[model samples]
Every structure is written in structure tokens, then in C-alpha cells.
Target: MDWLTFAAFALFAVFSGLGAAFLLRRFGGSSGQWLDALDRLERRIREDLVANREEASKAARGLREEVVGTLKDMAVLQKSTLDGFGAQMGRLTNSLEQRLDAFARQIGDLTKANEMRQEALRATVELRLGQLQEDNAAKLEQMRQTVDEKLQGTLEKRLGESFKLVSERLEQVQKGLGEMQSLANGVGDLKKVLTNVKTRGTWGEVQLGNLLEQILTPDQFMANVACREGSSDRVEYVIRLPGRGEGDGEVWLPIDAKFPREDYERLVEAAERADPEAVEASARALEARIKQSAKDIAGKYVHPPRTTDFAILFLPTEGLYAEVLRRPGLMDALQRDYRVNLCGPTTLGALLNSLQMGFRTLAIQQRSSEVWEILGAVKSEFGKYGEVLDKVQKKLVEASNSIEDISVRRRAIDRKLRGVAALPNDGAKAVLELIEPADVEPD
Candidate 1:
């Protein structure tokens, strides 16, 4: 039997046993057997109570222990979380220190570079002094030769011959020294130029960069670039212009300061007496150099990111600008070699204008797309408004019916009236007669 039913029966037996025992004591030994059976039932009921209590106590204890264990587990989990956070924090700190150290090392490198620049400047000064000495020696030797020629004889020839051998050896020594001095001076000047470039705000270079940036679409090759090709053995501004988009070819444009400043300055000082042939010769040399430069850049810069192109040679200075344009057969030669064209400021400006036009066209196309998208959005919203209008029409019909329903309206009024005060029987009956209930409703 279930414990509840068993308990009920036990209770009844115990009560009966007590009554039988009382009856046995009051009446006769015939009731004494019933009393003994009732006593046995009482003992069995006690056993059931004790067993149920023990089981119930065990379950309660187990539940209480489980609650305590969960609390302890929570405490351990919290500690692990904190430890993991601490480890992460330590790792983050280490990474930050490593980055800081790298920055420090870069700073140190800059400092060393500055020192090397100072040393280079000192070397350049020594080289200039050496050049002055060599020049003075050469002039002295030339004067001595003139004197020997004027008084050519036994003593003179003997002295000149003796001096000539020594002069040749001295010239060789001076030439070697000149080479050493030139190397040193070149390195120093380069260092000074680098320092100036680093500190002088790069205004001229920036202007050139801006010009190129305006001229070329980003996809155009090296229009704003500065780097050396292996063959050129020099670094300068390089550009690549496309050829007539056909027959597998393109054009390269190399631009930099190529005017010989010293010669051009001399020419300006003597404009009336300037030797045109001299200037022309200088121009010829420039053309040769530009041709050389274009050819060199073609090997690397003008190569299709991996192929070749027809190229341009840009001379930023106008001193010899006309000379370059006037080179006979120059254009034909450039074309023959698959490296072509030479552009000056005027042509460069026109190129930039074309690029700007292209960008403007692209921008207009993008705006047209955006306008189409906006129209589509407006059309979609119009459809949503159509759905809202339909829903509003349904609601308006419902409102009309609700207002027409006298029974529903009166029910609401009655509720509101009853909320404020209790209705008297007469008033309540009169109010109730105001409307009739509907005979129909939705099932």
C-alpha cells in the first residue's frame, strides 16, 4: 500500500487496539485476543514512521550538502576567472614593452644616421681643398713649359727633360688623389643633400608629387614615383604613359632636374655673345643623357609592371627645353626603339586635365546610381504606405460599426458610471432601457 494509506490503516488499528485493551480490562478475556492483535499493529506503525523519517532526513541532508557544494564550486570558478585575467594582463604588458623597445631602437638608428651625415660633410670640405691644390699645381706646370719653349737649347732641354719625367709621375699621383677626393666629396655632398631633403620640408618635391597625383589616375604606373632602375645607377622621378591602346605597347615618361645649372647660368650671363653651337652641343649631350635615362628606366620602371613600353623623357628645366624638342629625328629614333615621346609643362598640364575629366565622369556615374537607388527606395516605401492605407480602411469600418452599436456603447457607459457610484434601482432600470443587445455575433 501507499505510505499514506498504510499510515491511515495503522492509525485506525492503533486506536482500535487501545479501545480493545480498555474493553479487555473492563470486560472479559474474550476481548484480550483482539487487544494483542492491535498491540502488534501499533508496533508496525511505529516502524513505518521511523523508516520514513530516516529516508526523509537523508534526502534533506543530501539536498543541503548539494547547495553547499555548488557555493564552493562557484567560489573556485571565480578564482580561476581572476587568474586567467591576470595572465592575459601580464601578456598584454609584455607585448606593449616589446613595441616600445622597437620604437627605441628606431630612434637610435636615426641618431646614428645623423652622426654619419656630419662625418660626410667634413670629408667634402677636405675634398674641395684637395681640388684647389691640384689646380694650382697644373697652372704652375703649364707656366714652366711656356718658359722652356721660349728658351729652347742645351740647358733648357736638359732641365725640361729632367722635369718632364718627374712631372708625369707627379701628375699620376695627383690624378689618383683627385679620384679619392672626388669619391669622398661626392659621398659627403650626397649626405648633406639627404639631410636637407629630410629637414627642408620637401616643398619642391611635394609640388611635383601633387602635380603627378593630379596628372595620373592611380592605376597609371609610377607617375608620382621616385626610385632607381638597376641600369640607370641613379634614382629620379619616373612615369609611364599608355601608347595608342593597340599592337601590344605603352609609353614611359621619366622626369627630373636634368638642366646643367653651371653652363646654363653662364649662358644667361652672356646672352648676347652666347655660343649657339656650344648651347647646341650642351643640348645634344642632354638629349643623349635623357635618351640614356629613358632607356634605363624602360628596362625596369617602364616595363609593364613586367613588360616594355614606348617612353617619354621629361626635362623639368626650360633652359634646354627647346633643345630637346628640336633634336632632329629624335621622335623617330624613340619610336624605332619602342620608347617614345618627350613632354614639357604644356603637354603635362593637358594630360592632367584629361585625368580630371575621367574622374569627374566616374563620379557622375556613381551619383546616377545613387539616384536610382533612392528612387527604388521611394517606390518600396510607397508600397508599404499602400498596405497601411488598406489596414486603416478596415479600422475605419470597424470604428463606424462600433459607434453605431448602441448596446456596446451603453455597456461601456454603464461600467464607467458604476465605477463612480452605486446605482439606485429606478435609475439603473432607466439606464438599462437606453439600448438593446445585438441578436448576432461572430462564432
Candidate 2:
């Protein structure tokens, strides 16, 4: 397994080969020996005898060194073996002493085991006492568990009663709250109606304004502005229509709020009847009122002084809107004179949203124009600042050049100060400080 073992085996093989080689030299054919001799018959053989002898001597020295090394190794092994024997003898004496120690320990162990047996007996008695104590503790624990269970049952009964009472009270409170909520909703509806009534104009104006406000938008049209110069019948509002008219002027729109409620109620009552003649008469009466109101609005809002392409009659009530639409030839007659736009609450909301978007867009454009002007002014100011900085930089360079030589400037300043010292003190004369003396020299 080791290199030394392999080397020993190899050396033994070499010795055996040497023995075989000697035997072969004695008994082998003479021709083989002659061939071996002829192999050394080169031209350089005789010329390099000293070199060959030196090489042989080196090989002999290496063999001798190997033999000496092997002998030295054998001596080292012998000395180590002797030292190992002495150490083994000393270890044997120590082992014999340890055995004597074991004999004494056996005596101590027997004495200790006897004491341990007595202790074990005492521990057995203590273990029985502990068992008795555990039993007593277990009995006490059982009594405590029984008491805890009884108390838990009593507390659970009280808690369950309290929970049931609280649940009943909560149900009652929820019911009361629901009733209050319903009452609040009714009050809110009433308040909304009153608010609508209060926000509109006078009794007639309030009704009309409320109807129109609910049915039309404020931004798309102007309300209650003068119709014509010195005119008593002021049109309610003028609507600025989308398309431009002739001469690129804005197209006009008419918006009215007046409605006849007496005729409307009569018609509704007549509509529920089976009498055709009565129904026709009531329809005629309602048509007459519609025509009269339309004619009045047209004269006030769609006339020569208040001319408009289209007009609107704001009908706040849904029933009124349906009734107007159902009237045959009524819309045609009104539209023939002036384009009439009839709107209810829903369409009115859409119109208001459109007007809001238009206003917002206009304001944004105006604001952007102002911002552009401000930015342009800022750019101009920044350009002026750049020019001023360049001027300042030139002045700074001139100043720096004037004081380039610090020692010369200091001597010149001292000479000038010595000349100024000869001047009279003029603390009370401010004029002398402002004007230099005419006779002053450059020295």
C-alpha cells in the first residue's frame, strides 16, 4: 500500500534479476555476449572514455548513497523500536498501577452501592408519600372543577338573558329608527318643494320662473332682460342660437314661461268624460288659450323689435307637455310664425350641461392667452438681464486690470494719501467735498 513497500519489492526483483543475469552469463551462448560487446563499438566510445567513466562513477555514487540511506533508515528503525519497548514497559507498569486503583475503587463502589440501596429504600417511601399527596390534590381539583362548572352554568344563564333583552331592545330601536327615517324623507320632499317655490320671483313670476328654470338653462339664454326700448312687455329671456344669421350676426331665440292653468284643468276634466261634443268644446277652449298665449309670446319675444328664429315655451308639468304635443295643428301654426322649441326637465338638463362645457372652454382659452402673454414678457425680461450681466462683466474686467499690480497700487495709494494730508479739514464744508480744487496736481 505504501511507496516504501513497492520500492523494497522492486529492489528484491532487481537482486533476483542480477542473480539470473550472473547465471545467464555463465551458461548463455557466446554469440549473445559478443553481440552485447559489439553494441559499445561506436567511434565516440574510445574518445569519450573519461566522460563514460565519470557517468559510471556518478551511477556508482548514487547506488552507494542509496545503500547508506537504507542503512541509516535501519538504524533509525532499531533506535525507535528500543524506545517503543521502553515506553511499552512503562505503560505496562502504569496499567498495573491502574489495576491496583481498580481494586481499591471496587471496595469504594461496594460501600457506595450499599449506601445507594438504603437511599433507594428511602426514595420508595417518599414516592408513596408523593403519590398520596397527588391523590389528595386530584380530589381537591375535582371539587374545584365541580364548583367552576356550577358557577359557569349560572353565569351563562344570566348572560343569555341579558343578550336576549339586548336583542329585543335593538329590534325596537331599529324599528323606531326606520319610522324616523321615513318621516325625515317626507319632510325633505316638502322642504324641496318649498325651496323651489321660494327661489322663484313674485306670485306669477315665481310660478312662471320656476316652470322655466326647471325646463330651461340660464347660461344658454338671458332671462328677464329688456325686450325693446321703452317697452312695457319685457320678454323673459333671449336665447343665442347656434348658427350665425345673415350679416354674420347671432341668431335669436325666444324663451317664455307663461302658461294658462284654468284652461288646462278644464281640459283634463273634459278628457275623462264620454261626451264627444263637450270634449270638442273643451279642446277648442284650450286651443284658444294656447293660441292666445303663443300669440302673446310671439308678439313680445318674436316680433319685429324682438325678432328671433326660434322660440320656447317652458312647460314645467309633464302633463302640459303631453297635452301640447297631442294638439293637432297647434305646433304647426306656432312654428309657421316662429320656430317654437318645447322642452321638459330632462332635455333642459342636457342643454345646461352643453352650455357649461362651452363656458368652461371659453374661460380656458382666455386664461391660456393671458399665460402666453406673461411667458413672452418673462422671456423679454430675461434677455435684458443677460445684456446687463454682460455690461457688468466688462466693467469688472476693467476694474481688475486697473489693480493688477497690488504692490504698485499700494505705493501709489500711499503717495496720494500723503498729498491729501496737506488739505485743510472741511468737516463743516460739504461743498469742498463735492468739487475738486482747480489747482490740484497729478502727483
Candidate 3:
């Protein structure tokens, strides 16, 4: 069957062939017997080979069946292990899903609780804010009412004071108006009196007299004098001056007052109306009136040897006097032709002062010789008085010598009596009365 059995059978067959050859050689046999032996041996080898092949085929079949059975058993065991693993995975998956669901529910509850707490806090805060606003509004309204009451009282008091002051001022104004009305009536009466020419003349004369009284002594001037020897015209006033010669009578200086009121009024009216032509005409008329008055005064009063060569025409007001002076060449012409000088109240006062000084000078000159004669007589008497004064001085010197001798004797007596005691007042008086009763008198 295997190589070893085949080799053994081959070796045995060779030996048998050899042995048969030898036997043939020794005992010589037939060829047919060897052939028949060979045939039998070949047949045995074939039977053994057939048995070995059948056993090999059976073993191979048994081994193939055993391998198939072991493979089946292993497959069943692997299927069981896979089924257990699949069941465990399914359980782990379900537990994880349940835990996740519980966590989600807890989170939802916490969120609801937080939202409710926030809503409650918001409502409480809003209620407190509304209460605060209501309290503030009530306080503001009360403050406003208090301020209004104070302002109303203050305004009413101020208005009352203003009305009282205005009423007092009105009363004062009414009183002033009444006084002004009375003054106006007095002015109207004066105007009526001035319209008459005789009354105007008398007023001028009175003003002249007042000025003379104030400035000049009564003996220095005379009123209503007929300065012209042969004329009936009398001047208002004349000042007395010394004559040129010692025996000559006192000289007179005539002063007459004039008022050209109508002409002056016309000029003032024209100036107020701003009419140049009317003003010029009125001024000329005033100038002519003044010249006529000057001529009248000169002709009526001025006389040489009795009065001054020139006379003064007195104007009652400075305004009239100034107007006359303003006329061109008017003052010079009046002085040259009429021998008259223009003067107002102020000018007349100044002229009188100058004349008073002149009178003083004249008086001093007239008494100069008498003053010299008195001085000579006083010189002669003064010499006699000096001789008498010398005799009196000699007598005074002798009296002084005698007084010195008496003082010396009195001191000597005082020394001798120094040791004697003094007497009391009553004892000394009794002793003196007893010694000289006729000489002693009562206290």
C-alpha cells in the first residue's frame, strides 16, 4: 500500500525469482511452473494494494466529516455571544435617555420661580413711586397759597400810601394858585394908575424925593425950587454948592425926573413881535421924547451965577436911561445944545456922593484961616502954662523932702517902742478918747 510495502513486495519478488532460477539450475524445472508462481504472486500484490487503497479512502472520508462537525459547533457558540452583547447595549441607551429627561424638568421649574419673583418686585417699586409723587404735589400747592396771601397784602398797602401822597400834593397846588390870583389883581390896579399922565408925574417925583433923602443931607438940597429968576417953572430938586467968591450966595444944581412910558412900551412891544422896522421907529420916538425933556429941563432950570451951567434929566428906571444912551450921538447933542445930562437912579446917587465930597472940601477951605488963628492963640497960652508947671514941680520937690524927714522920725519912734507891750482894741480906744475926747469920733 505505501512505498515501504511496495518496496518489500518488490524485494521479495526478486528473491523468489532468483531462488527459482537457482532451483532450475540445480534440479532443472519446467518454465511453466515459474510462470504459474509468478502469476499467483502478482495476484496477491493486487489484492493487498486494493485493501490499502480502500482503507486510505475510508480514513480520508472520516477526517473530512470530523472537521465539518467541529466547524458547526464553533459557529453556534459565536451566535450566542453576539446576542448577549446586543441586549446590554439596548439597556445602557434607555437609562441615559431617562436621566436627561429629569434634568430638563428641574431646569423648567427654576425658570418659572425666577420670573414670578421679578414680577412681584416690579409691582412694589411702582406703588411706592406713585405715593411719593402725590405727597410732593400737595406740598407745592400749600406753598403757592401762602406766597399769594403775602403778596396781596403788600400790594394793597403800597397802593394806599401812593394815593395819600398824591392827595396832599394836589392840596398844596390849589393853595399856590389862590396866592397867584391875588398878585395878578394888584398888578392890574397899578397898571390903571400909571395910565394917567399927572399920576405918572407924581410917581416920578416921589421916586426922586426918596433917592434925595437917602443920599443927601436935608440942608444940602431943596425941593420945588424956581431956579430961573424970572420964570414960573419950578424944578423938583436942586443941590447947593459954594459960590466962587466968599460973599457970593450958594449955587444950585437942578435935577428933574422924566418918564416917557408910552414910547418905551412901544419899543418893547416891537421887539417882542420881532419887527425890525417897528423897533427902529419906536426907538427914534423914545429918543425924541428924551431930547424934548432935556430941552425943557435946561430952559426951565439952568441959569448962570445961580445954578450950574448944565442940568441933569433924571430917568426913573435904568432901562429907560440905557435906551436913551444907546441912541447915536444923542447924549453928546443934548449936552452941547440943551446943556442937559442924562442920569438914572444909580447915576444920580453917584453924582450926589461926589457933590457931598466937594461940599466937605469947600467947608475945610472956608475954615482954614480960623484954624490957623486958633493954633497961634494956643501957642501963646502953652508958654504961660509951662511957667506954671515949673513952679508946681519945685513945690512937689520940697514936699517930698519933708515926707522923707517924717518917715525917718517915725522909724526912730518905732525902735524906741519895740520893747513896749501892745494894747487891745478896746483899751487903746479908751486911752485915746480920754486923751482927746473932742478929736476922737464914733465908729
Candidate 4:
């Protein structure tokens, strides 16, 4: 039931009770039960109201306390959460600031290093270019100097040679007549000396000795050397010839000088006078004398196995040599019967040159033998050197392998260093992006 209906019922009950009591009191003045009953009912109502009021007040106070306590707890919890969140934000802020500082430092360092390197590279390039320019300038200067010197030297040498040739020709022309007069006087004196047999022989010997001295060293020729074993048959000159082969003893080659200038002069005079009988007699006499001289030289000097099988008959003058050769069968008879070979100054000179060449060839052969011995020793040592080089090469290869291993490790380390270097920049950028500017304010 509704509270208003209940209240209206109670009020009607109270009024009914009072009216009943009043009527009773008026009807019967001595009826006290109805008054008592009304009082009790009123008292009961009042007590009930009091009790309800007290209970409602107590319940409202309890509800208010509970609400206040809940609000206090909520406030504490929110404060704690906010405090923890603020601490975390502060730590993040400090860390981000530190990372950003490090990143900035790295960037600054990299920029400074780049600038320094660029400056150094530019300086080095300039220095190298300057040096190259200087070197080129020096080389050009040197080449110019060398060319100038060579050209000057060549010109001086050619000029000197040309002047010397011209001077020699002029001097020769000036001396021609004087030289011809001197030669004619000399021929007259030579003819007078030849008139004495002993003086002629001495002159021939001196001429032969001079020729020998021109062609050979002192040790190679001896003058007035005796050749015959029993008799004193001394020769004008004897040349010591080298053996045909190694270890063979040297052989002596005897030479005899026969001028026979008088016979030659008689032949020449007869021929110039155009006297046929005198020319024939003179030529025959010259031929016979030369043949006899060859025989005498062979018999005295041509001793085989000691001296050479043939001896030389030297005609000091070319004209005399030519006359001897012009005699029919004279040279052949001398070679076959007397074992003598004829030679003039020109022919003897050619023979001496050939002998010098032979000596040179023999010396070269001896040097070659020594070189072969040295080469053999060098070859033996070279084989050992080759073995040592092989060992060294093997060691070098081993060292190279070790170096290769170290290089690989170095490469890996370099990569790690590069990765570490990049971390400050990239990580700091990410951290900076996460932090907002407002979040850094103090609560």
C-alpha cells in the first residue's frame, strides 16, 4: 500500500477514536478507558516516528562516509599512477637528451674530419703538381744543355780534322822538291857503301834487324844467332815461331838478307842503255847469284825439326825482288832444290801480320778454356741457389696465407666499427621522435 493511504487511514482512526472518546465522555462522565486508549495510540505513533527518523539519519550518515572513503581511495590511486607515469617520462626525457647530445657530437666530429681531409688532399695535390712542374723544367733544361754540348763538340772535332788535312797537304807540297834531292844523295851514298863487301853485309844485317824490330817484340827475334850444331853458321835474324799445337816446342825460322844491289844496278844500267847482249848477261848473272844465295841459306839454316823445313831469303829492295821473280823458273827451282822461300819488304810485312793474327787467335782460345771452367763452377752454384730460392718462395707463400687470414678478420672488425658508428645517429633520431615537447613539462 501507498504511504499516503496508510497515513490517511491512521489519521481517520485517531479522529474516530477522539470523537468516540468525547461522545463517551459526554454520555457517560465516568468512562476513562477510551481516553487512555487514545493517549496510548498517540504515544505509539510518536515513538514509531522517532525511531524511523533516527534509523534514516544513521543510514544516510553511513552512505555519506562510504562515498567519501571511495573518493579518497580513487584520488590516491590516480595520484600514484600519475607519479609513476611522470617518473618514467622524466627518465625517457633524460635518456633521449643524452642520445641526442651524443648524436650531435658524432655529426660534428664527422664534419670536422671531412673538412680536415679535404684540406690535406688539396695541399697534397698542389705539392705533387708543383714537384712535377719542377721536374719537367729540370729535364727540359738538362736536355737543352746536353744537345748544345754535343753539337758544339761535333763541330769542333770536324773543324779540327779538316784543318789538319789541309795543313798536311800544303806541307807535303812544299817539301816535295827537297825530299827528292835528299833521296838522290842518299842513293849515291848507299851505292858507295855497297862497293865494300864487308860494309854491304853489315848494311844488310842492320836493315834485316830493323824490319824484325818493327814486326815482332824483342823476345820473338834474335840477331846474329848461330844455327848450325857443329859449325858457327850465324844467321842475321831468327824468329821463334809458335808450335803448331799445344805442348809442342817452339821452332826457329832462320832469315838471311842478301842485297846484291850491284848486280841489280848493272842489270838496270844495261837495260836503260838498250844493249841487248849486256842486258842478257847482267840478267843471267843476277839470276845465278840469287839462286846460289838461296842454296847457301837452305844448306846452312833449313834444318828440319829444329828449324823450319824452309828458310827465308830476304831481298831488302822491291826492285831487286821483282827482277829475281822475273827470271824464268828461278823461284820454282829455289823452292824445289834449295828449300828456300823468297820475300821482299811488302811480302814479309803481310806474313808478319798473319802471324800476329795467329797469336791473337791462340790467346783467345786459352781465354775461352778459362771461361769454360768458370762457367762450370757458376752452374754448380746456380743449382744450389735455385733450391734455396724455391725454399724461400714456399716460405713467402705461407706468409701470404697468414696475411690473408688477418685481412679477413680486419674486414669483419671494420664492419662492426661502422655499425657502431651508425648506432648513435639512427637510435638517437628514433628516441627523439618518440618524445613530445609538451611531455617534458613538470607536473
Top-TM-score candidate index: 3
* Model 3 CA deviation exceeding 4 Å by range: 1-186, 432-443
What would the per-residue lDDT of candidate 4 be over residues 1-443, giving only the tens digit for each residue?
54544665586578667767676766576556666666666777667656765676687689779999999999999999999999999999999999999999999999999999999999999999999999999999999999989988988998898889888887887688678778888888777789887778888788878877887778887887777788698888888887887888878889999988779999999989999999889999999899889988987888878788998999888999998999899999999999888999899878877877776787788699898999999999999999999999999999999999999999999988885645485587696776666778787
- All candidates in order of TM-score, best leading: 3, 4, 2, 1
Candidate 4 error regions (>4 Å): 1-207, 214-217, 242-248, 359-372, 391-443
lDDT of each: 0.64, 0.68, 0.84, 0.85
What TM-scores do the predictions have? Answer: 0.32, 0.34, 0.55, 0.46
Better of 1 and 2 by lDDT: 2
Clashing pairs in 3: none
Which pairs, if any, clash in model 4? none
Of the pair 1 and 2, which is ahead by TM-score?
2
* Model 2 regions lying over 4 Å from their true place: 1-204, 207-223, 239-253, 274-281, 303-307, 362-368, 371-443
lDDT of 3: 0.84
Q: Count of backbone clashes for each model?
A: 7, 1, 0, 0
- Against the true structure, whose lDDT is highest? 4
**Can you give the lDDT of residue 413 in candidate 1?**
94
Where's the lowest-lDDT run of ten residues in candidate 4?
Answer: 1-10
Q: Looking at model 2, which ten-residue stretch has the lowest summed lDDT? A: 197-206
- lDDT agreement of model 1 with the native: 0.64
- Backbone clashes in candidate 1 total 7
